[model samples]
Target chain A: MRVGVVTFPGTLDDVDAQRAARVAGHEVVALWHGDHDLQGVDAVILPGGFSYGDYLRAGAISRFAPIMTEVIAGAQAGLPVLGICNGFQILVEAHLLPGGLLRNDHRKFICRDQTLRIENTSTAWTGAFAQGQEIVVPLKNGEGQYVADAETVARLEGDGRVVARYVDVNPNGSVNDIAGISNERGNVVGLMPHPEHAVEALTGAGTDGLGFFTSLAGVLA
Target chain B: MPKPEILDPQGKAVLGALPRLGFTGVTDVRQGKRFEIEVPEVTEAVLAEIAKMADSLLANTVIENYTVRVEQDA
Candidate 1:
């Protein structure tokens, strides 16, 4: 499988995401924000960063980027798309996912090794994990709080669309401690933690994050 | 403005400081953004257009709502 990592202005995790895909035994493709082409990759990962300097709002400006037009269409056609951290913001802004992320309740930027429970393993990104398994990944963001209307929240919970959840502690006051979610088809996933940063034991957080990248093989199988 | 259910930390912080400054009687405070657009003319169509822009980009409907108002030059 070939994985494409998109780089928007101020994006800081594209290289790490590409490396993670490579480590997972997949060829890596680089995608750009200014281009509308996906270059024929099997999957796309929107990595973390302060895109457009988070102007107007986190992920607001980047929602209109040239690449997003293709991403939105491709995602609708069942392309596997993973959005991490700032990428998650863009996904919500593009209405690819329900709800929205707002400033953390504490009104501060938080960075730490966060524990998240894999709540759903059927998604394209989480298929490698066992049910209710806990994994630690680096979570860093100021506008990381997840919010939604009462109806949307209930629908997501009832449909099992929530893919992952914060465990032990909710760092950003996300509703239901939601750390990640997946679309109805389980092809599109958006998560607040930086799994790409945890792909290697050399990075100090262990190899848990590699599952996200490796899950592609099982998804395409 | 942020939805009634959404927590507004910035407003909370401002509320915390008001009593210390001797301005007591303020019940609550919510911080929000205001945008002033200079349109060529303030028609119903123009206002509706601006409202649409606010809906799509100027505000995140999930967390905030916006209103467009026209002011006459003094």
Candidate 2:
């Protein structure tokens, strides 16, 4: 399986994501935000960053990028797409995911080793984790707070679409302590944390995030 | 949707500073941006368009809410 990591302007984690995919036994493809082509990759990863310098909202301008027309089209057609951090914001701005991310309630940028529990391991991006498994990943962001109407939050929980939940502390006051969520089909998942950063012990903590990439390999197989 | 009242730190800062300048008995303050959108005319259709822009772009919709006010140029 070839996992394409999209490189957007100011994208900080595309290379790291590419390496994570490669280490998980999948070929890595470098996808560009300005290109309309997806390069025929089986899956796409929208890496973390301050895309377009967070102008007009975090993911606002990036959604209109040429690559997204194809990315959104392919995602709607059931292609597996994982959005991490700013990529998660892009997903919501692109209307590929419901709800929106807001500034942290306390109005501060936070960076730390964060613990998250697997709430729904059925998504294409999270299948490698056991149900309710706790994992630690590095989380860094300013506008990582996830928010939505009460009904939408209830529906996501009712349908078991929440893929991950923050454990110990609510890092950014995300509703329901949701660290991540998946689309109805589970092919599209978005999370506001730096999972790719935690893929290796040398760079980050224990390789708990390797499972996200490996899960895609499992899905493609 | 009615936006839940979350304390606006920026707005509070302005509220605190105003009293030092001799303005008295101010109960509250919620400072926000005001944009004068230039439209051809103040029609319901144009006001609706401005409202849409406010909802989708100008306002964050999560922490901050916005209201669109249209006034015709004399």
Candidate 3:
């Protein structure tokens, strides 16, 4: 499968995401933010970064990038889209996902190896893991707290749209300790942690994040 | 100024007990840090530069957003 990683001007994690995709046996396609075409890639990743220098708001400007128009259309057609960190913010800003991220309750930039429980494994991006599985991935962000109306939260819970929950500690005071979520159809997933940064065991963060990329192989097969 | 997390365990413990100490109507409270910067003169260019500094370093635009105000010291 060809997986495209979109690189906005200030995107910092596109390379890492591309490397992870290659390691997972997918042809990695580098997509630019201004391009309206997806190059026929089977899946896409909106990698992390301070896109547009987070000028107006984190991911606020990037959500309207020309490439997102194509991404939105592809995602609607059942193409998988995985958004990490800033990319997740773009997804929310675009209304492709529910909820918004706020500053950490503690009000500081936090960086740590965060533990997360895989809450829903049936999504196209998480099918490689068993539900309730515990995995550790690096999380570094200042505004990682997630919030939404109580009704939306309840609905997400009721529909099994929540894909991951913080374990051990709620790193950013996300409502209900949510660490990640998927769209109702499960083709789109967004999380604040840098799963690509945790894909290699030699890197010391463990390779638990590989499941995200490898899960696509199963879906494509 | 950015609000810091209440990290001092003892401080948090004391604040946590304030509501029980008859401090009624205290909905929520968190500790924070305060900082002051002195600018030689305030100008549109200078203020814009400060905003850039805040965006680039003083705040992590990803998680923390900032508000800036200018006041002349008497």
Candidate 4:
């Protein structure tokens, strides 16, 4: 499968994401945030970054990028999309996913290897993992707290759309320890951890995050 | 500012520092952004447009609450 990775002006993780896709046996397609075309890739990954310098709130400006128009439309039409860290913020800003990512409750930029429980494995990017499986990946961000209204939170929990939850400790004070979640259809997923950063054992903390990229094979098959 | 349902750590930090600085009697502090927009004229429609902008870009309604005040022609 061909996976497209988007590079916004201030994007910091596009290269890592593209490398992860390539390592997962998918053709990597470079996508520009300023361009409207998706290049007809089967899947898309919005990598971590401080896009637009995190000005006017993280991901708020990048949500209006020319490429997001196509991404939003394609995601709505069941095109698979995975958003990581800042990409998750963009997904929320675009209203493709519910809730918002706020500043960490501790008011610090935290970087650590976090353990996450896969709560729902039906999503396009998480199908490789078993339900309730624990995986370790790097979590780094300032605005990583996930927040939503009471009703939305209840609905997400009720529908079993929560894809991952922080294990051992809630690093960012995300609501209900939610580390990641998927849209109702399970095609679009927004995860706060840097899965792309964990695709390699030599450089990353572990190879646990490789499943996020490899799962697309089953999804596209 | 963060909505009532959301936690505002920045505001809490300000509140904590206020008491340490010998200032008291202030109950709360909520850090928020203030955008000074220069428009041709302040009208009902203009205010509505500004509200739309606030809802769309200026503030994220999910965790934030924003208020627009018209500072006429200044």
Instruction: Quantify all predictions' global Cα lDDT against the true fold.
Output: 0.93, 0.87, 0.85, 0.94
Residue by residue across A1-221, what tens digits does model 1's lDDT show?
Answer: 98999999999999999999999999999999999899999999999999999999899999999999999999999999999999999999999999999889988899999999999999999999999999999999998999999899998999999999999999999999999998899999999998899998987488889899999999889
Looking at model 2, the pairs that clash are none
Candidate 2 stretches greater than 4 Å from native: B5-74
Model 4: per-residue Cα lDDT over A44-159, one tens digit each: 99999899999999999999999999999999999999999999999999999999999899989999999999999899999999999999999999999999988999999999
Better of 3 and 4 by TM-score: 4
DockQ for all models, in order?
0.76, 0.28, 0.05, 0.84
How many clashes does each candidate structure show, in the order listed? 0, 0, 2, 0
Candidate 3 lDDT score at position B6: 19
Ordered from best to worst DockQ, the candidate numbers read: 4, 1, 2, 3
TM-score of chain A of each: 0.99, 0.99, 0.98, 0.99
Give lDDT tens digits, candidate 3, residues B14-71: 5778977878666555543334679889999998998887765455443344788888
User: What is the Å distance of residue A64 in model 2 from its true position?
Assistant: 1.4
**Interface C-alpha RMSD per candidate, 1 decimal:** 1.0, 3.6, 9.3, 0.9
DockQ of predicted model 3: 0.05
Q: Write the per-residue lDDT of candidate 1 for residues B1-74, one digit (tens) a residue.
A: 88888888789889989999999999999999898788777899998899889988999998897777789866
Q: What share of the true interface contacts does each candidate keep?
A: 0.68, 0.11, 0.00, 0.84
